[model samples]
Target: MNERRTPAVAPAALDDIDRALINALQGDFPLAQRPFADVGARLGLAEEEVLARLQRLLDARVLTRFGPMFQIERIGGAFCLAAMSVPDATFDRVAAQVNDFPEVAHNYRRGHALNMWFVLATERPDGIADCARRIETATGLPVFLFPKEREYFVEMKLEA
Candidate 1:
């Protein structure tokens, strides 16, 4: 049976170098076949060292899965920014119900009227709407879906 996998580790505190790596990597990544090798070269680290450190960061849950953001709509795939106005009393239960879907890539608590937010990725363009309906039916909370209206290539950086 195919099962959903969740991060297992209690994320470790990052040192200054790790912080630098994370912040720097948020910008442009090379499109070459050996992109990590190119990234390592620019960062003054060996390719093997870069891979090891990246693995450590991932294992520690400091970084989620790394991948390119494609224009999914153009390719007939889909992604949605979804949220639920979950009550405080049943927040965990609602979150678990929503996360049970393979389509929900990740979800986190937020400080807002819509308290539980997540990103959903699906293979088909209609999958986001379907997942939202299923989650609403299962959790008894209205699922709000925000499909991307436009794609922007911005150079903004978030310093860690």
Candidate 2:
């Protein structure tokens, strides 16, 4: 859980096709036996070419992940968005401590007072609160839990 992620930037070799592919596929991914093939057809790309390009993107850390967004509660899981006000001097150390938990999906350093934000996912409803307390104990910082009471479907599209 302490493992750091490779820098999340598209490689310099990233091209138009990659950008277009990211944008096109971000919104709606077709559910099929060969979903990549279906997407390839729309983009005028061979199935293999599409798969290769996507793999390259991932290998280069351009895409952290590509998959379905699951509703955790339906699958006997739970998650929460949490943030903390980490001091500038201890940000890196504090972040590392926070990320040490297996339940932390990912953490981001943002340009705000509450600069460190992360998602915690677990297999049970109470796990979210437990994680917050654990993180607070580990980092000596109060965790602001922002759990969603109502679900919102926002179709976000990014052009690379």
Candidate 3:
């Protein structure tokens, strides 16, 4: 079995409620105008405390992004992962073009045959191929599209 290794971050400084808030907010937040207050009440904390801790967490970069994951298909949106064999000579320029698109959520340089990879989410299914074409034109390199054939559910929990 092959296991991918992820670097361990030094434990972040946090309080009891901060830790508890991390655990509680992992699954889902309550759907309400005062969502933080609702979450705080359930976790036995004040709304301001919950909000403050979340802000701290954000500032610390412990959470890269926190938002809703939409049912893209149902919502008439399309998504895919793509890679490019970006040569070292022009990687920076190519990467800039790839990242220029508003549809690109995030891109990373991986050490592999397909060195540059990114996830693209767009308004329609056709946008996947269109974005690939646009990227190719902008970067002057062939972009390979690798759409997900199946979905894998990943569960992660942090205990600090």
- On TM-score, the leading prediction is 2
Give the alpha carbon lDDT tens digit for every residue of 13-61 in model 3.
8878777888888777788999989999998889998888888787675
Residue by residue across 12-54, what tens digits does model 2's lDDT show?
A: 5878899888987786788889999999999999999999999
What clash pairs does model 2 have?
none
Whole-model Cα lDDT per candidate?
0.79, 0.84, 0.79
Candidate 3 is scored at a TM of 0.76
lDDT comparing candidate 1 with the true structure: 0.79
- Candidate 2 regions with alpha-carbon error over 4 angstroms: 1-11
TM-score to native of every candidate shown: 0.76, 0.79, 0.76
RMSD per candidate (Å) reads 5.2, 3.9, 4.6
* Backbone clash count, each prediction separately: 0, 0, 0
In the range 11-109, model 1's lDDT, one tens digit per residue, is 588877677677767868888899888888887888898888889988776677766767777788888899889888887777778888989976888
Clashing pairs in 1: none
> Which of candidates 2 and 3 reaches a greater lDDT?
2
Q: Model 3, residue 82: displacement in angstroms?
A: 0.7
Residue pairs in collision within model 3: none
